[model samples]
Target chain A: MTVLGYLANGLVFSSIIVLGSIGLSLVYSIADFANFAHGDTMTIGAYTALVTFGAVGGLGGAVLGLPYGFFLALVVGIAVAAVVAVGTEKLIYEPLDVDSIGLLITSIGIAFIYRAVIQIRFGSDFTRFGIQSLRPIETLIPYGVRVTLHDVAIVASAVVLVAGLHVLLQYTDLGRKMRAMADNPDLARVSGIRTKRVKLWTWVIGAGLAGAGGVFLGLFNQLSPRMGFNLLLIIFAAVILGGIGSVYGAMAGGFLIGMITQLTPFFSNVVEALPIGQGWLATLLENLITLEYANAIAFVIMVVVLLVRPNGIAGEGAT
Target chain B: MSLLADPKAAFADLTRPERWVLGVSVAFMLFLLGALLTGALGPTYFLFLVGLAGMYALLSFGLNAQWGFTGLINFSVAAFFGIGAYGSALMTAESSPIAGGFNPLVGLVVALVVALVLALLIGIPTLRLRADYLAIASLGLAEVVRLVVLNERWLTNGSAGVRGIPSFFKGWPVLSTFPETMPGLRLVVIPGSPIILGTSFWEALLNVLLVLTFAGVTFLMLRRAHQSPWGRVLRTIRSDEDLARALGKNTYSFKMQSFILGSLIMALAGVFYTHLNLYVGPGDLDPITTFYAWVAVILGGSGSNRGALFGGIVIVTIREGTRFLNDFAIPIDPAPMRLLLIGIVIVAVMRYRPQGVLPPQRELIWPSAVDGGGTTETPDSGVREQKGGGGDE
Candidate 1:
């Protein structure tokens, strides 16, 4: 692939990776334990979209139009995520102390519980979007390459969501209080920030964003229980590689990882016939390995970042 | 230092009660197990479950070295376990084209070295990240490792995962002890034995031997280390990193040492896993297994070695026990329901007795007054703030 195509692919990949990581980054830097249930939230979001599409209802009769169904499904997905985010806090994670390792372990336990419950409700089948993995966009300004509507929406939505988050954090009262608490708990409390209310908003908003991301993901690709679970690593890698607490860093990291993923496939073609390329090397890798799974590429990126900067991207800014 | 000031001294007091509880529970479990053996489960079936619990418990103990001992909360225990199993299997498997190229002893040594190096390579960069970052990186690496195994077809045979491993130690002692017959469940033995040890005494024997050795090693090292100045410094680091550093200790180095040492042991555990099943694969390397090991460390008491053993056994036993109890206890399909039991156990463990069966106190004598609770040492402060922080950790 040429450099331009690579850049384009990176942008496409970045949109998804950043889209996923932003919600997690928002929650983690500002939130506490890493949420394992985040994956299921994505799964639930995809299912909401599926149901709205009336794909399951195809067995009977399709009543809801695609656009209307999509909008309604979006609302349902967001609502479900919001409720789960809040409910998990109240029912499972809240009662226990989770500031440190203990809370982290508890989070893992709770995450498993959430996963199990979801598994019971939704069996282990992959849910395919009625649309193709990369549905062609209207191509308002065609550059010879076809941009999938899914890709376009992801890029468009990601831009809006990130800009919205920045504005919310800078301009909103809730954002101010969240930063205050993040800086110093006692001070935030002493300042009468109503930390609880602010936190509730943070999770509802963060989870809602994740729900939207999930829908976006399903539009572009097949949905499975493993979708979010698999992407979580890359999302985290993006967050860390960019800078843990820095949302913008996550966006940058996401794109970088996405490009690397696509580029590996590009790199392999050259190796198959290139002079000086070891026959064994190409042959050894050809049968089992491909790096399109962004998470796999993310792992390599994470190792380098960690070795170079243990504090994560943005270093001290991560906290 | 005051005896209790030394966690080991305080821990010694608790070991007796610790042994008593696991002893009684395991004994009663064994009796019921015998009933399982003679009854519908028959001879070969019970051995399989016992072995699975033993191997899983052993892996958990290896993880406890980090979470239970040094307080790092390593989450990729299964990844390392898988690495060890696969590493050794690659060396000894009958199908391996590379097997005959080297001496068996050399092959085993090379495998161990390879696994050890892999652990260090993965651990060196990631282990210093602290808390969630470390957890994230390890989780990422585990997937990466699995992907590497999956993608490297020539090396790992791709998704088929290298098979036809020569069963290590299966020939030792009486072959019958391994159980010549699992009857209908024989299919489970080679792929991932689930029935034979579930019926046999051999599983219990292996647990006793391995756990005893682990216990011996743990007892001696923990005793001397807890008393030694370095040990005190290590504990200090766990309690408060700033305080330890203020006192002139390099908390970073201590953490690194503990992490590497603990991870190396986890690799050894992988070796045990491979030998048991005579196979290894991506499915075996799932993250859920890692989470279960964390559950073991918590149940064992985070800071105490004996607590780790008891907790590891209990965790494994509970996993199998619930399955066993569900055999006749519940009328519904149990596969989906089993995790619910795990979820409940975790919730209960988190709430009423977050400290676990063994409290974190140390003792001066072998038989001491206190019982060590796994996960007792750390304050619940972080978790209490989880909800306040939003949701996802």
Candidate 2:
């Protein structure tokens, strides 16, 4: 039961990583800039969700009395996504016009500006939305198997988002244009496609997904001004490990990273049974590795995978 | 065709009287230092600042040889610096099973050897991929190193840090021999009468000798290297990689060498850092430390060895000065203003004079040489140079 509980927890965590990184890949593909602000886009969404839910009287006043906090998160998430989408294109991405070095420098500037603004306003401390909503269901599972309603939201939302992405890319005319442009912008432009429109639509959907992922993440963890900044490294590793521009690769990379992190403690328990048993290794990790640093576990996975396969598991163009 | 092909013309041009002014400037500095010692200023604190700046200049020289010469953006300076400090600490001190069942001297040697191996480890994999991947990977690697340092308390003493190091240059003894705590003087606050970073006279004396030895070696080696054919290849690679490749050079190996060498130099600085503080902590090597090096190199003019030294002095002075200046009844908030000023300097230099001050591989040609081709092959070749990192392919 504990293993299963761990698996559930892993999946919940993986869903957020996958979602966050997939946006990274999309923006990288479209804008051709490593948007350092992509993670902050998540912060913006999380903060917006909090504000939106507050306006809606805490998501519990609805008829079903179901976990409506997530429902509120969706609306606010989309709105934040739309705002950043239009804003970045108008204010940041479009103005830069795909110069790699310029884009890189400007994105760094954008990140600092975003961080400074967030800090000035939010005061650099962790704030949490209530988690009492998940307490009762967590106690009922055997193997002491525990799952929060927030975990349920993350897993369920991830499935819905991934499916929606797959269908959108496969079935829609807009996705068709985006894929065409991603393949070759010159050819797409020559083929009479409106690349700018496709890019705008891409950012809207991509950043909206980032926003939803942020809300899911913030619900599980606490929200701080620099909350998503550290997580960006792990997310980038996932994106690269998955493949630079692939969505599904990001998903696989995320879950792989998630399981590796959870399984470290699992390894310690297994080793404790050995003859030279040093429970010290596990206890040392617990004492020394801060929760903030747990995010970097994904980078090791990424560096290893990147060295082995720069093209990623799905290969190029396939993502 | 003129100066570009003739090394004699460039060497002869440096013999002029006005050019001697730059040489005389060094001598002038020596005289001024001599005066400041006996004069009203005393120059104790200023000398300390200069010593620290000289150490940083060596660090900047290493970085300049890497980034200025090789065109790499090493975002991992702090990690390498920490590695060096830990290396130095372990080498010069005594340790027991208390620190991972191994001695620090053994760890120090192991650390330096692994550093070169680590550079190759980081370089070979990422070098074949995008350059930015190296930047990202290196940043990630720094976090891993920091985490390992923190977690392996068995090795690093964990976040509380390792302390009680035997000082290599402990203190100056001769100049500070007059003990104020002696019954004759009665000058002691309590006893022993401490001065010079609050170290005993012997420790300060030792530090001066050690700092001078390290500084002398760095200054000479960098000067010798600057004039070598290898340095010429580096300048060419920085200007245009493909052109260098077209000239029958393998750019990658040189880049790898520069990276490892630069990292080793930073490691040396790290050793001094650990000994100076008598401790090693994870938080000591932050990104700000790396940027300080960048500021030094840029402020000093990227390719100039002497410029790096001067730049280090200027930047440290600005940083320390602004902090000290906060004590006055100033009406301005210099915190954000200072950051904005630094940012502007970066942007301004990049826009106007990207070759930086004291541009290396000095060959006087019109702007046309900035493009390798004649007027005939105008359009496509020009486009290629910009997009393709000026490979001349």
Candidate 3:
């Protein structure tokens, strides 16, 4: 594969991570606790999309005269995830006032409950969107790199969603309130920013994006109960790698993580493709660093970044 | 230190009645578990469950040392445990395609060393971050460990996993022979013909002994450590890093020491777990294992070592006790339901009793009444603040 192919692939991977990490970062900033269940929420989102797609079958974009009904499914998926996030906050988080380690542990409990629920409900079966017949529109690049419609959709939607969030944070009153609350909730409350309302919106937007990210991830890969759970560590890696509270850091971290994770397998390939007379380099690479270690690469980066700058690239200082 | 400085002040805080209450409650719980383990059908099956609970208790003790005493959140419990399990198994597993076949004792030492190194590697960079970031970073580290276990086929035997690990007491004569002829064994030395006194019984007894040795040693060590000046320093660091630093304490080094100690204990527990099962698999070291230990810590009471043990026993009972339900052919699979219930229990514990079943006792041993200085130690301020910080939520 050409370098462009890898870049396109990286973008596709980054798009989903970006969506998830944005929510993760936002929640971290506003809630001041890591939502361990965020990844499971993404899984829930994907399943919600799957359920919606089935329920709204073969209806084929007739309502909006679009190419696919998956878009509508995506909306439902987001709503479902948002409801879950909001409901959890109302029931568990709000009442608990999760400012302590208690909240962090509670999130872990929620993660387990959510993941187990998905398992019990879905029977641990690997499901897919099953719209493979709607094949990706392949585009042949000058170097014979193949980019597809699905990849384009993922990258395009990610761009649009991130851009939309950027505008909201930059221009809107609610976004400003959210930022203020994240910066200093007491100050925001004293300043009459209605911190509670901002928190509500934070969950809404964060979970909604996570839902969409889940759908995109399902489209890109297999849909298992573990799909989101597996991605969760990487999502965290991205969030922390970018710095906990920064929106832009999440974006940059997501892209870097995605690219690194996607490209790590190619290290072995690069070694093999080298014109070295000795095979030891490739052999060593193959043995020491296989494709399965892709996830580890993200973590290595996260740890390195954390060691160098605990606040993250965009973070001002430790929270 | 003043002669009146009661180092075990926290332990001494228990009134006579309170001590009796705790003792009786613990005795009752242990009696039930012991009965279950020694029953007609208990020797083989229930022993496994009891053994597992012991391991969980040990893991919780380690966690209690970290989170309970030091206020460090370690999501990498499973990774450390796995490191211990795999480290020992690789050394002791009988002639595998992969792994170094070393002595089991050496394996245990190696595993502890590995865990200590790993804790240092992970803790050095991330411990300086806020609590939540440490949690996330540890979670990532665990995943990285899992990935290594999964991908490194030559070392970990890949997902196929290293198997047939020799039990810690593999060929001990007492374990393999009839207890009647057993030479001067303590259990046999007792003036009673125990009904379940046989080879199998001896094997189970030895396994139980191994777990007890580890658990007892861990509890004592942790209790001693927590009561020491070092433990007091850790508590201070947890409560207020800035204050601890201002006091000229190397807070980072203290925190690292706490982390490494806790991780070593966890790895030791893992070694016990491996030998008990007599097999090692990649599947054994998932996030769920870590979560289970966390649940134990939470349920028992986070900061208290005894609470950790109680929590571990309770959780293991629930988990293993529910297996009988499966035999009765329930409408739904009880496995996932058990987990769901555990999750609910965790949330309930967090929301209702964030301080846990037994709140951490104030560390200040107030100067004795006749000491002419009945004032609390200066460290009491930090302890008070630590307790106050538990539920600012």
Please write out the lDDT profile of model 2 over residues A89-162, one tens digit for every residue. 77655644334644554454455455555654556678875544546263548655577655776788789988
Residue-by-residue lDDT tens digits, candidate 3, B1-393: 532577476446664534754786779667765654445344446667778889999999988888888889889999999999988888888756555566678888988888888888888877887787788778888888888888877678888888888777654555434333544332322235333445555556677888999999988888778876787888888788889899999988888888888899999999998888887788878988888888888877767887788788877866865665666656446667667878898899888877677655543332232243434544433433565674354
Write down the TM-score for model 2: 0.74
TM-score of each: 0.80, 0.74, 0.86
Could you tell me which 10 consecutive residues in candidate 1 chain B have the lowest summed lDDT? B363-372
Best-to-worst DockQ order: 3, 1, 2
What are the lDDT figures for the candidates, one per model? 0.65, 0.65, 0.80
**What are the per-residue Cα lDDT tens digits for candidate 1 across B31-147?**
866576445564544554555555555666566556655567677787777777777777877776355223334445665687678767776777667666678778888887777
Q: Judging by TM-score, tell me the better candidate of 1 and 2.
A: 1
How good is the docking of model 2, by CAPRI class? incorrect
Error in Å for residue B301 of model 3: 1.8
lDDT per residue, candidate 1, A125-200, as tens digits? 6777664344444453355345655566667777887788888877888777777766666788888888777777
**Distance from true location, Cα of A140 in model 1, Å:** 9.2
TM-score of chain A of 1: 0.82
Which prediction has more favorable DockQ, 1 or 2?
1
Point out where model 3 deviates above 4 Å. Answer: A62-67, A133-143, A271-288, A315-319, B1-41, B98-102, B171-198, B362-393
